[model samples]
Target: MFESIKRDLSFIQGLLEGDVNHQHHVEYRGLSRLVDVVDLLVESVEQLERRLSELEEYVETIDEDLNELELLCYDDDEEDDEWDHEIEVTCPECGEDVTIDEDDLDDENVELLCPKCHTVLDLEEIDEEDVETVISED
Candidate 1:
């Protein structure tokens, strides 16, 4: 199972390093191959878990192996942050958070007027960690 993963890693590395600009086919093909590798690994792990119920030590070893494989896929320098954060002004009249698309705004102190309330409210910087919590109660 690990051998298959190694091969898939090589495949992904090649695509990442190669000239991705000219070839669109390589992108789709590589992604599909990586997906297949993950699916196969998951199925094998399920079987391994069932068969090794008696030995806790063996299970721990398998778990470590899987964890290491997952870490290999992580790119430390890649800007993988989807939510490129920003400062959001509040609408004084409506009390709603007024945010702008990251592309349009410059990184500096500026007065941003809220279109919702037509109120130019001051904004504090927000980070990714400052996520709004939503709880659904039954």
Candidate 2:
């Protein structure tokens, strides 16, 4: 497309330069300048198109790298599943909800400290209905 446009502009430039015409006057100088401006604009547009193509390819490479990194870091099935479990217990003193990892509760009678109020909580005595379910995320 640039080639065809450049060819037509070249033809117009030749005509304006008085190579194929006898009217070599100052009144036709504006036509010559207009063709010069059009030629520069075409070249600038072609360069812009090339730059856009390069940027698109770079973005695709970055996206692929991110996906590969995620797969490599989270390849273990057990570890990924562990992150999906979470336990939510409310603090009796402050009434604030505290989230704890399921892995941290190794036994039935485990003691956990509340982060908000620094109160010790007994996980064994808490009823299941009082404990809220909180999903863990990576």
Candidate 3:
């Protein structure tokens, strides 16, 4: 790719200096038309590079998200894999739902408090119905 880019740049510079050859008349009009063609190629190459860069960034983001998701709690104890593992953030005292995820239950000892009512809810506090609803939306 770098070699190709360098060759294109060299071609552009040659065109700019009007050192390129043509079969017919060697007029400025013909060179100008050829420059326009090069300009289009350069613009297209730039656009493709930008798109590839964006795709790379998207892949990186997905990788990071996957890393975070892997840390989510998986159930091997009382509950089955399908519905046993989940994270729950809620008002512990009031039972109001806040944020829920599979990672919430990763550690049973951890307790998260709700911002609304200041209630402490742990991974066990989260309900299966809440998990079902949240998973459906995701």
lDDT for each candidate structure: 0.60, 0.82, 0.63
Q: What are the RMSDs of all candidates, in order?
A: 24.3, 8.2, 13.1
Better of 2 and 3 by lDDT: 2
Q: Which stretches of candidate 3 lie over 4 Å from their true place?
A: 1-28, 73-138
Lowest-lDDT window of 10 residues in candidate 3? 73-82
How far out, in Å, is residue 49 in model 1?
A: 67
lDDT ranking, high to low: 2, 3, 1
**Tens digits of per-residue lDDT for model 3 on 1-138?**
646865876776566566445535556567667767776777788889999999999999999998776655333422354453334444547766665556656767667677778766655545665544344221
Residue lDDT tens for model 2, 1-138: 999999999898777765545456565777777888999999999999999999999999999999998888777775777657788988888987888777766776667888888999887666787588788666
Runs with alpha carbons beyond 4 Å of true place in candidate 2: 19-27, 74-79, 82-119, 122-138
Per lDDT, the best of the predicted structures is 2
Clashing pairs in 3: 87-101, 87-104, 87-105, 92-119, 92-120
Ranking by TM-score: 2, 3, 1
